[model samples]
Target: MNLNQYIDHTKLGPTVSLAQIDQLIAEAIKYQFKSVCVSPVWVKYAKEKLASTNVLVCTVVGFPHGTSTTKVKIYETKEAVKDGADEIDMVVHVADVKAQNKKAISKEIKGIVKAAAGRTVKVIIETAYLEKKEITSVSKLAIKAGAHFVKTSTGYAPSGANVTDVKLMKKVVGDAGEIKASGGIRSMEDAKAMIEAGATRLGTSSGVSLMEGEKINGNTTY
Candidate 1:
């Protein structure tokens, strides 16, 4: 399947520069992917850069690490939305979940969802750190907490968006919500597979390169 529409052309890193965000916006405008995902710090600039275009602006809350306090994540979500972020992707507290502190994780995600104030909220589950049952429980909790999507990873983890995790999230959320597959999805094949496995959204920095390679080379295996 053609997976371009499922992409959120992403660029989130510790050292991502303003010039890089501009370039990301430029590439998003050129490619017209679903959106451009950036860090919360760059939301304002990313919003300004994307203002003229129809491309949506997305920024993360709780970020790569989900260790932030619930209040902090909520505050980050509020500030990100105020800065013009069209969508909020917040990381679910993996530690809380792993410790069986479901209440804390639920509260954190719910805070972010409410902070969104009706905007789209995607909860990152960081699947690499969770088992199958944990994945199911988190998906259910996120859905119950009013999240619009369940995301697979932070990309900073040891692994990202495996087909197994995608399928698991898909099974749990089903038609009630959406699933976003991210991290380590660098090729057209992986992107397509994620979509097939029920990922409605894809987050990756390799979007432009993926398309370029597809153009320069046919569907033959790389």
Candidate 2:
């Protein structure tokens, strides 16, 4: 497997610096990763740096937590797209999922998808906080709402991607949408497991390390 193609080389930390963003762009170009996922603030910078490269620029909306209003998330999506973001990864409102408020969830995702224009939108379900059934329900809703992908975590939660969750998400999405296994994936073994379970993209801060074949020892928060 060409792991580089599956990676969305990420650096979403609140304190990530310009130098780090430059490094992330350089690494993505060097390794030919699929995309560089950064915060909205750096979307333009990453886009500019990777303009001549194949790497896409991805940015997050309603990150870490999905409590923002639908309007706000939509605005974030629009601004990100305007700033040259090629992809949008937006967190879903877990409360809506927990409450089984399918209407609200679908509306929010649809709003963001619309705001994203034609760019890809990956819905982050933040699986750590949901029950298996909720995960399935939200994954279905995301697909129905036009999300291009269903992502596992925000890396700010208690846990991250697990094979079981990935498989379950795949079962729900099937051919309608793709899956992005994210967070805590620190080793080649972990990455392979996610892909085998049906992940088409990976969001991680450990892309370079994984490419170097180094298995990290501790938890990674995206």
Instruction: Count clashes in each candidate, considering only residues at least 3 apart in sequence or on different chains.
Output: 0, 0
Question: Could you tell me which residue pairs clash in candidate 2?
Answer: none
Best by TM-score: 2
TM-score of every model? Answer: 0.93, 0.98
Clashing pairs in 1: none
Cα-based lDDT for every prediction: 0.85, 0.94
- lDDT, model 1: 0.85
Model 1 segments more than 4 A misplaced: 214-222
